[model samples]
Target chain A: MPTLIKHDKIMEDDWAIVEVEAPADGIRRIVPLEAWLPESGDGLLLQGECEPDARYCVAPLIAINFLVFSDGRGLSLAVLLRSRFDFTGELRAVGDVHPDLLYYLNRCGFDSYLMPDERSAQTALSTLAPYTDYYQASVLEPNPAHRRTRRFA
Target chain B: MYRYDSFDQKFVDERVVHYRAQTERYLAGELPEDEFLQLRLRNGLYIQRLAPMLRVAVPYGILDSRQLRTLAHIARHYDRGYGHLSTRQNVQFNWPELAEVPDILQDLAEVQMHAIQTSGSCIRNITTDQFAGVSEDESVDPRPYCELIRQWSTSHPEFDWLPRKFKIAVTGASVDRAAVDVHDIGLVVFRTDSDEIQFDVKVGGGLGRTPVIGQMIRRGLPVRHLLTYLEAILRVYNRYGRRDNKYKARIKILVRAMTADGFRDKVDAEWAHLEGSPSTLTDEDLARMQAHFQPYPYDSQPASIDTLGSQRLEECAFDAWVRHNVAPHKQPGYAIVTLSTKLTGVPPGDVSDVQMDLVADWADRYGFGEIRISHEQNFVLPDVRFEQLFELWQQATSAQLGANNVGLLSDMICCPGGDYCSLANAKSIPLAEAIQRKFDSYDYQHDLGPLDLNISGCMNACGHHHVGHIGILGVDKKGAEFYQVSLGGHAGNGASLGQIIGPSFSRKDVPDTIETILQVYLDLRHEDEPFLLCFRRVGMDPFKERVYANPD
Candidate 1:
């Protein structure tokens, strides 16, 4: 079983991640976006290049697939999915995730991460929220530092 | 200069702590080398030819006296006693231990500075005219917008890991002093007839393997929509930019592949969706940022012009320094003074710790306690009193900062080539020094008039060789070093790329080749026309003929 970090804490994950061609018959399995029908209540898995559309907005969980940690297209996709499409469910990051990338992944609105192992999951938790404040607006904070904090001058 | 408030200060402090942790993890072997490379690059540390080179962001080229002292302290205490000023208005330390970079970042943060996003595949330090607020030709000061962009781009979540490095430049002056056309995103800020601030946005212009001028994607965009529009552009680039080949990954390649109109359509589509989001600048937001850049309290009384005129008449060196280095300021009694770093023997932008301290002291005594670094590798005192020009010039001459060559040929922009950069194909500083030695006479340089001589180690064009009036590019021929020369390039108003003269030259023959080209210009030029104008009027044929003709 893979380690999971949900809401910034290590936890045992029960949701199943199905591949694009894999059969996902149950509601607990997060099927690929192509496989998940609108009527089916199964969660959707989105690739980095997937079009962020409103059709998949009703999914209970959307796990963004990253082929490599350095490919940042999925980060922007998550931002658009949350801020523009108003996807208010569990946003998870899966595949090729590393502890070094957790801080940026969290900032871009990943609420859950499927880590490689237990030790890496702990490292990921430590790196998250390294900075209490940030300058720009994102999915986590709609208001930037200038709008949220009281400036001296 | 924009002062960092409590909110901004705290953000930078937290960043230093975060970077420190990252460095520790890498050292402990918990982080992989490939992953650590990206993390360290985001903090502006690059593993170079000989050692690690640390680049500190100057933030639109503006620095205060305190920040200058801090940089000097870093130079004295860290890996070296000297630092090199980059063409992007930032400073680079040639040698810094990788383990000690966090300490350097901590020192910089104490002065409200950081190296965040300086040299990663992300947004770089925003640059503008060195004489931003004081220049007489500009209607609006570009610093406030530059600050806004700087904050927005710092540690930006989605755009931090782009396919290639991105650079943005802003200019508000009638003349393009910031070299906006060569940046990833070039913004020309101006005011409408009704006193409304607006921006003309250009996209996908850069200098690297492929040096293409940026295209104007939008015109007369209101100031409030700046961030949203920028976000739209970045998002489009992040999603669609090439990831296969590093050389073809810049946004310019994408823009070229899609064509300007097609790329503009894509950007417009993206912008239309997010034009009025939470990122839109509010009236209060605009006012607050504008307040930070209000005009300095200049002396209202007119400077003593007769005294200055008498001093100039008395000393020919003072007159020449004033004629070449001083620029007109918006305020009547003030002047913008450029401290030339290109003193004959020294590498173009290299400055010692002592020189940094001296410049800081001069900034406090002669004008406001503020300094600026220009893209042409020179320091600028933004608010010098016209009456005190003679005194400052005399002091600067002894200090080697007063070279009486601001835009002249010897004040060339040369990059740290094979000496410091691992990516360089050939050495550049030696060629620059040889040329400077040949053209040592002030009378000859003054008679020759304004010329932009740029040199780069390789096709990366860090020295902006493509836009130089006389561009020299270092090339590698069968593992041996060779020099390629280009002519007729200019970076002002209507910027144009230079054309290669003929063939490559040996290192020993570069200076004489340049002399031959200049001789052609001198022989053909009418009266007092500048080198660029003369070259433009008479095409590259005459110069090419003169140089390549049998030199028996």
Candidate 2:
């Protein structure tokens, strides 16, 4: 079994990802965004294109699935969910989560991602820590680059 | 030339690490090909027909001697011994492994350079006039503003993933050598009577499948509002620009759909929110940017050098080289020498490693150790003493870099066509070569005078074919390649797109057709009237009739 990298830690992911929403087995089952009930302490599942505006209200945890899609709408959606909607809950990126998208996903909002295997997951995690500084203000940093830089005298 | 501070240096370092991770993920099979393509392209790496082509940015076409040597080192080590100077003022290496691109970016970062936004759908390298600081006609130098825009646009988070690629060009010179009118956003920088610098902001000008002359939306915008005003235009474009079809995605299509006036209204509405933002340029910021471009310490030189005069009187080649290749400088007795890369048989902008080293050495010897790359695909040494002209000309000729054709017919802007680029419809280099060989005679080419002949392999218009005095476009007809001819195009002051003369011609017939068009121009033009001015005065009807007269 592949080790899951979540919140900078390697651990066994127990949450079962599912498509439909309904009477769930408490927080163990991650259901579709539509099935996410308010304050029920349910985990919500999101398609790459699913809007995240209402996720902040109900879901205790949200997992955005990277659809077998070519473009990167999922990445942007994750970024917007955190940066715009201020979704502070445990965010997970699943489905066809390419190893390369992990660093960007981490920057965007995702605290965890489904990797193919343990070795690949560990390698992907290593890529994230190399950049000691970044240009843009993101989910990692709230202040933009202009505010971060030293202004000319 | 601009110097990098700690902030600039650190940003590049971080960017290299970021791109390196992206490449590592792809190599490790963690990132899929499609996802990695976007990341790699933004770093100026493209998978071409033969091999991967990596484009390294030279911001506003400016590079110092150290940067040039670093480029030479990269070209020598990472790529083949030569590099092609692109029309966008970036250097393209046709052969390189994708795996080594991050390493290439790392090397570039050490020199305060990165390939960020050189490709992909975002703001590109902010281009400016090649003679920006030293031009005699410029009232205020545009290089500072160019630097300001470049810094603001790099790693721009919001606009990184735009509907289509965006280009911005600035020019402070009276003559628009930068071709500002054909850019996505054209900033015409100038000073008011009170000596305050301002910009006449023009938007939605681009050359591609659809060619356009950018409409001036805002006139005399104060320099203080530079970043905020640009932010306004980009926000509007990002939100409203079409994304449905790639062909119709450029800002020009958006501006045309909503008339220029309507687009201006939208931008005005957007600007209202950003006008007083913290991003606005402060006096200190302006001074800091300007400090990097302080005037060179020029030694007063005689108006005419005795040796140069004697050489000119004796050797016809030296006289022709000076007349065509050299440009007048703002500083007295100094001249800007253009080292033409458009030698016969060679591609328009291809320069070798030894040549680059030679030019870098010459820059240090004759002037400031800096170089500028023109969009016309030539190198410029901005400061050279009058006395050094004859000697420089002799050395340059020996290197085959002394084609005394700056604005002449043979000095064409040709793109790397089907041979290297997958997007090309035909080969542009061969067509340029055929035309150059036909008019190789210096006397004939000089007599033709000031012809902006441009050829593009495809409708992407990388060569800016639409703005050429005589534009030639390679069109894909069925499964075969054909050439399309256009007339009366010009990129400067009165910028206009060339009108198609007739039906597309076979590749073999292109040179003859151009000859016929020029023949008609020679017959019709008044004394000392240039080819473009004459063509504009009479319209394409005259040339059109003659070229198509013997058509089957």
Assess every candidate by TM-score.
0.98, 0.88
- Residue B306's lDDT in candidate 2: 53
TM-score of 1: 0.98
> lDDT for each of the candidates?
0.91, 0.83
| Candidate 2 residue-wise lDDT at B490 | 87
Best by DockQ: 1
Output the worst ten-in-a-row residue range by lDDT, candidate 1 chain B. B302-311
Chain B TM-score by candidate, in order shown = 0.99, 0.98
In model 2, residue pairs whose N, Cα or C atoms come closer than 3 Å (at least 3 residues apart or on different chains), thus clashing, are A99-B30
DockQ scores for all predicted structures = 0.76, 0.18
Give the least accurate 10-residue stretch of model 1 chain A, judged by summed lDDT.
A18-27
Error of 1 at B546 (Å): 1.6
> Model 2 off-target regions past 4 Å?
A1-125, A134-153, B300-307
Model 2 root mean square deviation, Cα atoms: 3.9
